[model samples]
Target: MESEKYNADLSRFHGMIENLPCGFFIAQAQKPYRLLYANDEMLRLFDCRDLRDFCRYIEQDVRNIVAVNDRERVEREIGHDLQAKSDRFEHVRSHLFTRESRIRYADISGRLVGTEEFGPVFYCTLQEIDIPQPGQMVDRDIRDYVVGHLDEAIANQWIQVYYQPVIRTLTGELCGMEALARWVDPHVGFLSPAAFIPVLEQVRLIYRLDSFVLEEACRIMRQRMDEGLPITPVSVNLSRYDFDLMDVCQVLEQTRQKYSLPRDFLHVEITESALAQDSAVMHQTIDRLREEGYEVWLDDFGSGYSSLNILKDYNIDLIKLDMGFLRTFTDASRSIVTAVITMAKELGIKTLAEGVETKEHADFLASIGCGRQQGYFYGKPQPIGGTLAHIESEGRGIEPRKWCHYYDVASMFIRQTDRACALFDRYGDGHVHCLYANKTYGEQVHELGYQLQDIEEDLGRPETAEVVRTFWAYVDRSRKSGQMETYFYIDGGDYVNTALQVVCEMNQHLLIYVEIQNLSQSNAGRRQSKLDENLRYLYTMFEDVYLVHI
Candidate 1:
């Protein structure tokens, strides 16, 4: 839209924002950063008596309210936002000192507004966090340290890029790596991304940090090729904040061009929460990013709300399934994972399962045809140069152990193949107990007029001793090798063929899955079995994986 039209639409915006709960203000988009307007809330926020006092106090300079040490970084960030002509709202958190010398931590969100008369202005809001205890106000200290040292860190090379490997699930090939930012401070020692990234984002210093990581990732990819070192496409995380502060596509494109990297040499991972805030704008940005040759991935896909809507509406290259889902490794989680993967697949998008810490999770994902797996099981994220060296010497690391138990196998098979299935737990050299049995398996058990668990006591009987021995032996081997075991047993003069799969969960408990195939010399029974198989696969397919779009 043209500036005049935008101005007409926003003509009432200035007044409308005054009704908002938080502090609101407008200032010159460019330096010397004179305040053009301030709402009553803003006055109260600064502990000013009124507009006149607020104006006279700051001398028209916005920096006066900003703590002295943060002025340079704030200026740099705002300057960049202005130069970029950013249209999106930039959330910048920092300390705004009051007239009474009290410090207030403010989360300031702003965007440049074009006006017919003023040319352009910075329209912003301020939200203050609580005051700290005596001498416990370390937020400012950390903010100062980061902003003060960030430039030097970049120049003197304290900020480093780390690469965590992403493995192809089916073949366990090193498919890709995510570029993580790490700070090895000269005075403070090692600062994980968790430590300084939030501080940087709060202070709106993430642009510098994110840009550095992107360029460095591209450079490392190019350098690795030049050095004959093995390399894969590196994914660099772009903050949702990036869209507000500057033109993310332009920044990334320029960096990619500088490194002369291929279109797919670098990828982008955006968290689900970031996209949820403003789906329309984010969708456009993602589409533009993809159009510019960058593959956009929805990182931590199932970690938030409206995920199904994101998949349906946004055109993304891949979805990184959040590792938190696998923390339970429960039936519901497994079903949900299947649902997500299946949904993504149907939408012509790929799935990358994150946090494959255990061999079980990796194997489960692989068996279900998940495209990629990334977690500590493969390799922890490490420094770029060190990772390159390690990969050169060790190759893409070893294959993850495959541990598919009976339940894992049945969960996959019964849902896909439509075989009658039940689960049982073995006691200390005594009871062979049935925990739960599926519908088809329950039909056979119902014919014997006994509950599933009731069959356990019979396992000790002379007639059932053979089946018990075979089942327990198989359970032991299945747990060790992480593979399924098969055996046949006699129950009431009937031959029941079964496959037992054992899965060891996080709690160190074993779940034994039994798949039963009813074999009899009756055509009617064989026909019934075929019907069960066909109809079961269809029901389980939809049951195991249901697409959720809203």
Candidate 2:
């Protein structure tokens, strides 16, 4: 369907061609496609009016622009079909002066139009597309847009708060709720924190966002109470980035005052990996939140080893499991379930199993004397309809789950294949990685090995078939070349960078493995503070191992 064509004053385009600094041309596809017309600027720019001129003047061909050895093959593709083509069209060959004319990348667009005189004219336009100019924001409108802040009224209207209930398995009571936030941008629809929090953090706007979430949550909770719903306590998870500018305690206090919220009615859930992250920062923050009457729960207890110790070290209120455990909830998950729950019990820390999906999973967990559970089994995460409503009946919460895996396997070392070095180890050439590590390392003794690709993917994973073949290679390197230094992951399934020296031990090598955590990647770098932190970094050396299979 052809649309009506509109015509403008011919002089408008003619004036543009004459004054433009770059050259412009009109060529025919007929032999040599003799230049139909060339402006004075074209002659002045190329230093020659002659279309045949080369050397200093480079003739740009549509075909040559796209590099291909077969010029005839390319010429065959001149019309509408370029299905056989793959690469982008670049300036196949340009003169020294052609490159000098453009600052950054030259922007180009091409269009084919049939003209009354020329029949078919491929119009190509070039414009300079460099980096934003130094004074790009000098314009008043742009300047105002950069420093502007969202007004309170507009912000409050678009911001929404949701909550996920924290359940007490013993009574099947909604112990508390964790506040979640959703932002609706007038222009962008709904926005997730993953999309905006980093921007806010970069601009130091996270504190304000956190405050918004907390205040809104409290307001919602208060309304729920008035509606005869009893969801009193709520937890709010915060990012380490938010705490960088000011203490979270002070911020929370301000929020409490601003919202007139109860002290004990609100709790802060800190991830276990986060606590195991920066002890000093975590201790200071938790202490202050506690001092301010906010209960602190350690989220995701079994994520890291050092995190487990936090229950004993820090004044934490609750322990939550990482969701990864849910994937292991098959009958095979029996041992791991019992071991983790037992440890949490001994520590006097309340452990909440997360991501419960099925009734059998809930049953097996209950059977193990596990009282608390949270997951899809109870209900899905949803907007608070006043208060948290859970499936509850007067029943015993803690019972043994129909757990299939024996508890001894997941929690303790069992020598099945061969005698292994209970001591963890790492050995590899910098480029060709063949690491050896295990969860039971230092508790068991064995020589393990793996290659670079195998090791990188197997960071927190167990040994596999590919690992066996790679193990043999490491053995060859060690037996023929002698001792070497390398970094590897140990256990907990996550690799921790550690130094391991391969000792040609018909037995075991001394100090063959060294755990070296840069501390830069862990929670510390994020907290932006330095303190003595022990990651219990099992993955650092325990899990990721280099093994040589003979």
Residue pairs in clash, model 1: 405-501, 405-502, 406-501, 406-502
TM-score of each: 0.50, 0.42
| lDDT tens readout by residue for model 1, 335-413 | 8888777777667677788767667887788556577788766755788666546555656543322321222222333
Tens digits of lDDT, candidate 2, 1-550: 0000111222322222344454444444445443344444444433353434422243434322322323432333232122212222222111112222321222333344456755654444333332335533212222122224334423656656766555554335455556766554443233334435556656666667677777778777677657765445677877666566667887788877766767877878766666765647767778878787777887767777786467667887666765466565555466776677777666555556776655666666654545456664555445776324333332323212121111111112212222222222222322222223333343322223433344434532434454334444554455566654333333433333343333433212211322344334446434733321333332245644344436
The models' CA-based lDDT, in order, is 0.68, 0.47
Error of 1 at 298 (Å): 0.5
User: Model 2 misses residue 330 by how many Å?
Assistant: 4.1
- TM-score between candidate 1 and the true structure: 0.50
- Count residue pairs with overlapping backbones in model 2: 52
